[model samples]
Target: MKLRELAHSRTGDKGNTLNVSVICHDARHYEHLRREVTAERVKAFLGDVVRGAVERYELPCIGAFNFVLCEALGGGVTRSLALDAHGKSLSSALMDLDIAAPD
Candidate 1:
């Protein structure tokens, strides 16, 4: 199953960093997502687009996870030549992640 089936995401950017928040549709799925979505997994999935470290912050209270991706924007929005310099599309991309169906 795709992560999109269980959650949605929001994205923000600062300089070369990207922040992606994944929020579960159902709070009960939080633990499952926490187990499956790790900083290393996210970094690997994003590939070279993310040039720096990936950090995951658990938000159990809100059934969400916040991922901070460093050096991902090519540079800041003003400096980056990429069309999606703010990386808004990254949220959609992240939703494509594959995960085992919740038991």
Candidate 2:
């Protein structure tokens, strides 16, 4: 029910920006993910944890949605402790996504 439970995250540093990729499992829930998760929502969820633009990508072959969080590492990896800026954390954020189990 969390991002940690639903998918894995990879963090990268590009200049003063942090690039994070949230790769979801159970590709079948892609539609639910698309409907429930949005850049604005993600920004609200992440809050000060990371800043910048959020982009969503759907990979039909993998049935996974990839979220690219830009400039979220708080001035790059060196300065970030990777804390959840909003208290909900990434896992909690993912849990917030409305996903339906296979019927």
Candidate 3:
């Protein structure tokens, strides 16, 4: 299933860091996302989208995962040449994760 169908995302930009919170629609999909969405996958997905090194963490308390992508925002918005840094790039990149569909 599509990541959008499985979860909702909250994205943020702090200087060169792009912080993303992915909340799963259901707890059942947590393992699927956790197993499939690795740091490598996140890095590759965000390569063109964010432009940086990615660090992903799993949050058991929230049943969600957080991704802190460094140097992703192209240093800053003004320097990014009007790119829709958080909205366009981050979401598109996260969508590439091969998360399993809910059964």
Best by TM-score: 1
- TM-scores vs. true structure, each candidate: 0.98, 0.60, 0.81
Candidate 2 lDDT over residue span 1-103, tens digit each: 4445555555545555544455657665656655666677777776776567878776667655566667665555456565643222454454555434433
Clashing pairs in 3: none
- Kindly list the per-residue Cα lDDT of model 3 for residues 1-67, writing each as its tens digit: 5677787788877776877888888887888788777778777766675566778889967779888
Candidate number that wins on TM-score, 1 or 3: 1
Model 3: residues >4 Å from true position, as ranges?
Answer: 86-89
All models: lDDT?
Answer: 0.94, 0.57, 0.74
**Cα lDDT of model 2 overall?**
0.57
Q: How many backbone clashes does candidate 3 have?
A: 0
Expressed as tens digits, the lDDT of each residue in 1-103 for candidate 1 is 9999999999999999999999999999999999998999899988999999999999999999999999999987999999999999888998999999988
Model 1 segments more than 4 A misplaced: none
* Alpha-carbon shift of residue 68 in model 3 (angstroms): 0.5
